[model samples]
Target: MERTLSSDLAFENNSAAQASMPLRALSTLMLWQRRLSSRRQLARLDSRLLADAGISESQRYEELGKPFWR
Candidate 1:
């Protein structure tokens, strides 16, 4: 009975771990997608808008140059 209970617990733990993997990947992908979208929007900003946001053209260019993964 004890061995059976322990095995059941181990299996449950393994299942939880496996289930979390896809969630973690999805979270990362969403984060990267958001970053990409934000960068694209930033690229569309006019000079006045950039200044209003307190971001310089150089800073915007630098940020745009970065990969979404970063």
Candidate 2:
């Protein structure tokens, strides 16, 4: 009975660890998605709007290309 209890505890610990891996990966993906979307939105602005935002066209392109760098 003691051996069975130990095995059960080990199984539960492994299961919990496995479950957490996906959640961590998913949150990382979501963060990257948000960054990429923000970069795309900023890239969509016209040169005048970009100028108002103090971002040059070259800077906008650089930001768009590295959306996930942040």
My TM-score estimates for the predictions, one after another, are 0.83, 0.61
Q: How much is 13 displaced in model 2, in angstroms?
A: 6.6
lDDT of 1 by residue, 48-69 (tens): 9999999999999999999999
Q: Give per-residue CA lDDT, model 2, range 2-68, as digits (tens).
A: 5445788989999999999999999999999999888879977998899899999888888887749
Candidate 2 at residue 1, lDDT? Answer: 30
Poorly placed runs, candidate 1 (over 4 Å): 1-5
Clashes of each: 0, 0
* Candidate 2's TM-score: 0.61
Best of the candidates, lDDT: 1
Cα displacement (Å) at residue 40, model 2: 1.7
Q: Of the candidates shown, which would achieve the greatest TM-score relative to the real structure?
A: 1
